[model samples]
Target: MLKTLGFAIICLLLFGRCAQQVSPTGGKKDSIPPNLIQSIPLNKTLNFKENRVELFFDEYVVVDNITQKLVITPEADNPYSYRLNGTSIVLNFKKQFQDSTTYTLNFGDAIKDFAERNPAKNLKLVFSTGSSLDSGRVYGMVKDVQTNKPLFDALVGLYNPTDTLNPAKQKPFYFSRTDSSGVFSIENVQTRNYTMIAIDDKNRNMLFNAKDERIGFLSKPISAGVDSVSYNILMALSDNTPLKVQRTLPKVNNYTVVFSKPIEKVKVTFMNKDSLPYMIENGEQIKFFNVQPHSDTTLVKLSVTDSLETSTEFDQKIAFQAPRGKERQKDQFTISSRPENNRPLANSFSYRLIFNKPVQTIEDSKIELITDSLTHETLKNFKSTWNETHNELTIEGKSFAKDTIKWEIPKGSVISVEGDTLARTLIKHPVLNEEDFGILRGKVIGADTSKLYKHFIIELMDDQYKVIDRQYSSPYNFIHIPQGKYFLRLILDLNDNKRWDTGQVNKGIQPEPIIYLPEKTLIKSNFELNDINITLPKAP
Candidate 1:
């Protein structure tokens, strides 16, 4: 009797310890995914007619992002309602199934363990209403035309155009997104003549709305036979109508006018057809300078006249106006000075004044130049020359050892183009030291000796990969560098437009290719790094 009671007590203690719950403390993280134990009607069931499915898991599971993860082919009118039953998932379909068809549901990363959120691998279920399943498939790749870079998760679809229908107007019969390598495939498509299209679908709607969507399509509908068809798509945007004025922006000294597409030339005039002073910032951006101040709002008309023909460019003429206060609207022309505190006059340099508008006059009497030498005497002889636009003044002078030049422009000494008085300012700049700067010279090697190597651009990038200097690539490349890590990149200029251009879809233009060097160049202080070679690869 004593032995029996002891054994019963020991069993009770052991069972109690085994049944107790444990808090997640220090241990190896749960890396194992959930396991599917069984499913209703079995997986890949032929002639399946059930409206509901129950999936049993080995451990407790949760269904999250059901809409995004669960992709159903031949989609029903409504969505599936999911229910959690401990270690099981109950999916009830609200829509009826189609007749004589194979329906597939891919639970993509949705079935995850409740505790660790580790998902089951490739959870898919398929059923056929008929005797067999459709084996027709479509596979292809998607890439950016200009960069030749893969576009992952881009949508590729097929539409059956039984009627005269536009591919962008309706949803596709079958669709799939590209994988990490920009590859896409759709199965069970039902062999037929289909209009194929690929799009960067931003709205998640299967249809293509051209306003913001990039599209790639075939010239004619493709016939999908029993065999899988391979189609490669190059994603690009359709070019907008040319010569249309997009918008106008008013800055402190200039009005920036933008166009819908690149134009060779543009003409700006007042309502009275007077020629306006303008600068071409780019093929699209035009800057009109020295706009006269008006007491009230003024109307400025812009016209774009291309070589082919002149259409009514902008939908409406851009308007211009000046400020209504005694103060001028333009921001003050400020002078920034940098002086080399150590090793002064190490290199010959220029003292400059960058003005926003053309300077009407400069009072040389009020200008004083003093050097931070022992004597600290003011200099009288100096020459100033303005740039072509008259907006910049470069002071030509001689350099001295251990001397820091101080330039002082007194108040009301300089006049703006608007006849407004300028304020007093002083500036000082440091000369470059050979010891502080490094010289980098290298031979561009490993270039493909093909005819396609002509118009490539060699770009010197900083540590952050920002362009520090750009030059036409040469056999021997040279540039002065400050002590920092740098890299080189080569861009193939196909259009000879002086820059990399993105391709147009409707125009069938491909984007320029770029070759980025993997090796990094480190420029150290007081060191001239020479014989550094850079090799460029073939264009993609």
Candidate 2:
């Protein structure tokens, strides 16, 4: 009985060991992807004629998003259906491939191990139905024009010059994705005249959407052959969406028009023979005041143009709503001054007070300038001039002594158009001597000489990347900058709008070029950093 019981126990142990499953533990985890063991028709097979192919891996593998990751150069009209059979994947074509053509199948990170899910690296297969495969190859690196860094995973493609399909709308004839280093090498390409382009493909659809993607292109087509051709591409916004009125919000006294994108120029006029006072803000919004409750809704025509000179007219209806139930709180009236901190106010540097709204009045007698808390004088000779918008008031005239000074405004001294009164305020600053600051002088090279008068802007920024001072043209001299680390940025104001503008793809207009001084500029007090040269690229 004991022997029989021991035998039964042994049998139970054996059965349990056979039925239970457990993963191996305690060693280095598998970080490597499955390696391809073999292919049914074999890779690089020439004069191939097959409807189905099988890929074998040493370990069990999973096929992931093959439809999106598998790119067939000379893109296939019908996609291949793939299935995993244990350790192998079988691909069945929906239709036959082109006759006597070299085909490249780039299975980009689609095959991976089932256990760890590490993707198979560089899984590309080349085959040809002709006597020989196309040996053409194109290699290049893609970089961002703004950041000047490698653009990884950017799609680099080649297209036949005569193809009517747009790069933004269709896939390329042949393409390769950039690696981490922003280097791409498209192999097995047909030797022909092709237009090469690169794009940051945010969507996996393989089409360039100018509204969402950045693109780079060669100025002209290249005649590619068996020899490898090399070119560096730079990607930028290349935006081309037309200016559109996204929405119109009406208030009791005013209506605001918000645009879909930024515009350099805009003109709003009533289509039905009416005029309204309007002011544009930030190139994206236009606020029109209804001085007289002229109409509940009015037909207005908006004529707008971008920096690229692409213009569009939009006619829309503007409607106003009567004030009801607890009117919305108005924006808080805020005041701010520049040259803050301990930074000294230098010669010709005006002390300015900026407000959130248009200022209606300022009692000069209630404002006083105090020097070193000893001498006090009212704002008499100082020319307090409001800007065109009446939101910025510049006070200049009396040369402030180097000693610490303060500007004081008593309660109710200033008032805005909305009847908001200024509270008691004090702004103190110091006027330092010339020895406390340094000078930055630089010149821009390669800019169009004729366009330099007002079309180019050079800015000197502090270490924190804030614009401290700017000059309209170069050779530019930024005077009175405190001793610190600085940098330079140049803006090619192509439209002479005093700001940098992005590109428009439909108009074939690249962005207004911007170049940065690669290295930081160290400014020492009582010294001048001179002859900083900035070289601009040829206008696209």
Candidate 3:
């Protein structure tokens, strides 16, 4: 008390009259919250009759977003309104005070200064209209159940089963939002057995009607007594609603259908062997293409099944018609390079040319290397390979010369299916030296490629948990790591999709297993750390 009072005195001395003017820093930031100078009706007053109240502070104070941070309980039909008067808050109650009951005004982090804006801490002022004030108090924390991480600003409420009801429709008897650490408390609560609820109110309507709103609750009623009752609530996203077709868009030879949630097992049927666009199971979108429109219109159906195969949800067959009017311009087939243009390349590196459309021809005789507008060295012998889709072109050579070499593709050297010639282009490739990289070689033990789980991923991450590289092969070896400290995480690829799958609560399945190796490794120039085996963590 003395230290805060002294700080107030210093603040007053630094800037006069509530410090409305700017004050120079005293080489230290004022972390002390706004100190209460005085209050009307005083705190803990028994048989208090005054309805109007005023709280004076040592500095200019402002309260913003009071509806979210302020709570008055047991609640009144009409809320109190307040105004900032210089360094004071003058509050006028709208309803008459109840007799023999304790009323609490919890000012949670809403009151701050005009300058530094340092908030006043959890300030609760309690008073009684009758003989004595209620002594009961309740405190607890709220968090996400799956991630086990703290959630701040979550609404925590206590309700009497007899008098109060759904928090979705009305306010509870007492409520408060979680602090920065996910902790909340309501002091001077009435002594009673009450049902508790916590909600991540997304819309700030003080309700839980939205589909994305999270809900948590105490398993049973909490009985408040003279001492505080502490409890915790784990929030979870409700999955009671079944997946339904949210919308569908039909185009030429394709149907873009989206569901409310991710569906693992889905069956799509149509006359044409339509191809759904590649989307992870976690995404809600899927597209069907590679179709031949025999008629002007078509109908397609999509059915989704749950993991247990107990029930199947189906979407109404959507009808699509051929588009009318002018045709859209076709996208020109373009070429892109790898060990990319103007990039440093090693002598033994393989070059690649990726085309948006399949290339009809690559005139090998017209491709050559150049330097300073003069003809340069050419590949003595090279191996070329193309994918089945003809969209990729890979060229492997024996070795590249040391000079900063230039590659040239003469006009008409390459042609697309439309018979359009590729414009001549040039690229510069510089040889990469030895100091640019380090090697990472490690081993992953206890991997089983059985029916249940076929593959595991060993990922190298920086200190921030961002994955730098991931290897799915045995022995878990990675080369050419930049100089830095790295951590390792092993993921049990349950579905052999080569990615960790998130849990689906409705389907009753947990996420794919992931084990983070406990140790961090540092790699330097020309360093090789071998025999490091990272074992999977045992599930609890």
Candidate 4:
């Protein structure tokens, strides 16, 4: 009996220990690995011929995804030519000599073992095919020209200047990723003329598609030879192609243009009596097409033709210049209502106002609500809150009885941290009707509830699911919004950085994770004006 009791106690204790060890609540500790020691031919070597290259590390390291991670410059004819056996990486050239040619192979996040995934970090092997590697190299940092901050993971490439060599037809002779510092370096380049282009590779394909991507180029060709070159590359937006009319909605005074890129200079015009184009006012990027029927129908031709002069001409081709990627500013302010679709006949629904830029202060006097076709009155008992993630201002008040409301943001009412004032009459006449506007509201729960995210964003979408409204909030806070279907998402404002960041290939840092609310939240017309709420998941 005594022996059995002792054995039973031991088993119970062991089981308890095992349960504790395997429990998900018992946090597992992450391991750290050794750093890279050295590499042969040195990084950024210029001019010379050699059949083999080697890299030496301090510890018994292993190569991670060398195949996917290695990027050879001046890309060789035979690309699959490198071998990573253990601590060393070997490269065998398949083709014979090209005189005085410079080559660079960037081992991006590929020099780590299977154990910890610790990266060797920016390990590069550079050599020359001729007696001398080109001594000239260009060094500089890439950034959003407007923001003046380093743009991480921005692919910076060097191209030989030739009108025939477009980004789509050719690959860069040499390339490097912008480091966290937004700095990039291309070395061992021969004495010749080249152009620097930086692209935000939204598609992940190295090629730059002007229609879908953002590109920055030096207006002039750069000459490189004996000296190491340095240049600061400011990426600007480009309008490479004309706007494409996606769909036309003659019913509403609005149509959709699927731009090849985001354009700032958009102008729409109607043909005058002399067949000359007259500008349609208030055109902006993305949502540029407005149909509010300027003047009478008799003044303009209903079936206008393009320069092509096709017989059935309801379409007009407008030349537009897209703003540089760096200069594209996100439109922050959004207006939404609850019960997104099929709003009730009653005017009791609430209205939600969202902003994309951070608001330092909001003057209530500048906000006025007009109801019932012209009863302009100050919203009574209005309350406002600032959301840092969406950079929004949430204003709430008693419900109204009408389905349509004219929301006005007066000049000098909204201010930023820098005290930069919004345009006088920024939103002079924003009309929210039952057919288009909707509200989205949600709560943000952090991975560690005790740890609070600085801010959260809620975005509302139109019928085509484009973001039309947005709201920012604090964790666990509830916001009442308009009646419309919306795709709800949240961003943890970790560094207080206003922008989302992509992962770095060299540093092995994955892009910051954005948490999206599961399923599209729908606000129906019958929903209690104050009863709609949404909850956001935590970032993994």
Top candidate by TM-score? 2
- Clashing residue pairs in candidate 2 are 239-504
Off-target runs (Cα >4 Å) in candidate 1 are 1-33, 40-54, 73-86, 90-104, 109-112, 116-122, 126-267, 271-299, 303-312, 315-331, 334-415, 421-430, 435-453, 483-485, 521-540
lDDT, candidates in the order shown: 0.68, 0.78, 0.69, 0.54
Among all candidates shown, the one with the greatest lDDT: 2
CA RMSD, predictions in order: 8.5, 4.8, 11.2, 20.0
Clashes of each: 5, 1, 0, 36
Give model 3's TM-score versus the native structure: 0.57
Candidate 2 residue-wise lDDT, 1-540, digit = tens:
999999999999999889968876799888989999899678889888887878999999998988888888888786678889989999999887888998988888899999899999888888998889888888989987765578999999887765364787768888888988999988887888788888888887777887668888775787667786688887887667666778878887668889887776676668775656565666678776554536767888878886556788888777766767685445566778876645566545577877766676888887888777777778865777876556777887565565777778887988876667877888877777788789888787765454443477898877776778787876788888788898788877877877666564444456667788888899989998889988876543
The regions of model 4 sitting more than 4 angstroms off are 1-65, 81-84, 90-93, 245-540
Lowest lDDT sum, 10 consecutive residues, model 3, at: 273-282
Tell me the tens digit of each residue's lDDT in model 4 across 335-421. Answer: 333433233323433445553334556777656766655666564346655442224445555445344555566666776433455
Model 3 alpha-carbon miss at residue 43, Å: 5.5
**Residue-level lDDT tens digits of model 1 in 256-305:** 77776666555555665343455455556766655553423335655675
lDDT of 3 by residue, 188-259 (tens): 878888878788987766776536777777645788878865788777665435677788777654456777
